[model samples]
Target: MDLSLSTRTEGERTVVVVGGEIDVYTAPKLREQLIDLVSSGQYHLVVDMEGVEFLDSTGLGVLVGGLKRVRAHEGSLRLVCTQERILKIFRITGLTKVFPIHASVEEAVAATD
Candidate 1:
């Protein structure tokens, strides 16, 4: 699937709904959107990845960079990922310890520091 992204504010959190593959080719798009949001002073992001069909190392790098950027501003970045395949990548790479992953967007948005 082709990459797609849409953002909406939910209370104080920005929900970014992502669809399609996130690989070397599409990772830059995700990275740019994230940088724009953070640079614009809109942090508290919840990335809903339910529609994501595939994610590669490049995508993981982008997410890690996003986390660093948010942390620099004392902000937070959460994720919503229900796919076992995707979740397994996080586990294998030890990113499960780095990010707060929820099964639903609502749950991820509700999580607080």
Candidate 2:
């Protein structure tokens, strides 16, 4: 399936609303978006994946790369995802410790760590 991504500023954080599948083909789009946001100095990011239908290893890599980018600038990258399937991927990969996952965009934006 195709991937969709839209970004918006929420207070001090930028929220990237994502929908559809994020596999090898579509992961690059997400990687580019995250790179653009960080390059433009919007480091504090929240990737809202509630609309995400599927996520593969490549997508997880993109997220990890985004996290690394933000962290390099002393910024943060959090995730807004409540899907058990998606969450399971993180848990299984032990990425739940690497990234802070929230249930909502608001919670992610308000988080301080």
Candidate 3:
């Protein structure tokens, strides 16, 4: 499936809502968006992944890379993921400790503040 990314700013945070499968092919799109946001000086980024139906290792790597970039700039990266399978992957990889995973976008936005 084709990947789509939508950006929105909530207060001081930039939220990127990602939809569709996030695999080797579509991971680059997400990486590009993250880089754009970081380069634009928007350090506080929240990735809303509720619309994502599938995620692979490449997708996870993109997220980890984004987190590192944000931290390097003294910013933060949060994730909004409601998918059980995805959550399991994060938990297994110990990314749940690395990233603040929220149940909804509202929660993530609130945490950013």
lDDT ranking from best to worst? 2, 1, 3
Q: What shift in Å separates residue 87 of candidate 3 from its native position after superposition? A: 0.6
Tell me the tens digit of each residue's lDDT in model 3 across 2-108.
89899999998999999999999999989999999999999999999999989988999999999999998999999999899989989988889999999998899
Write down the lDDT that model 2 would get: 0.95
Give lDDT tens digits, candidate 1, residues 4-106.
9999999999999999999999999999999999999987999999999999989999999999999999999999999999999999999999999998988
Question: What is the lDDT of every predicted structure here?
Answer: 0.95, 0.95, 0.93
lDDT of 2 by residue, 1-113 (tens): 69999999999899999999999999999999999999999989999999999998999999999999999999999999999999999999999999999989888988986
Error of 2 at 58 (Å): 0.5
| lDDT of model 2, residue 41 | 99
Q: Indicate the TM-score of model 2.
A: 0.98
Cα-based TM-score, every candidate: 0.98, 0.98, 0.96
lDDT of 3: 0.93
Clashing pairs in 3: none
Q: By TM-score, highest first, what's the ranking?
A: 1, 2, 3
Candidate 1 runs further than 4 Å off: none
Which regions of candidate 3 fall more than 4 Å away from where they truly are? Answer: none
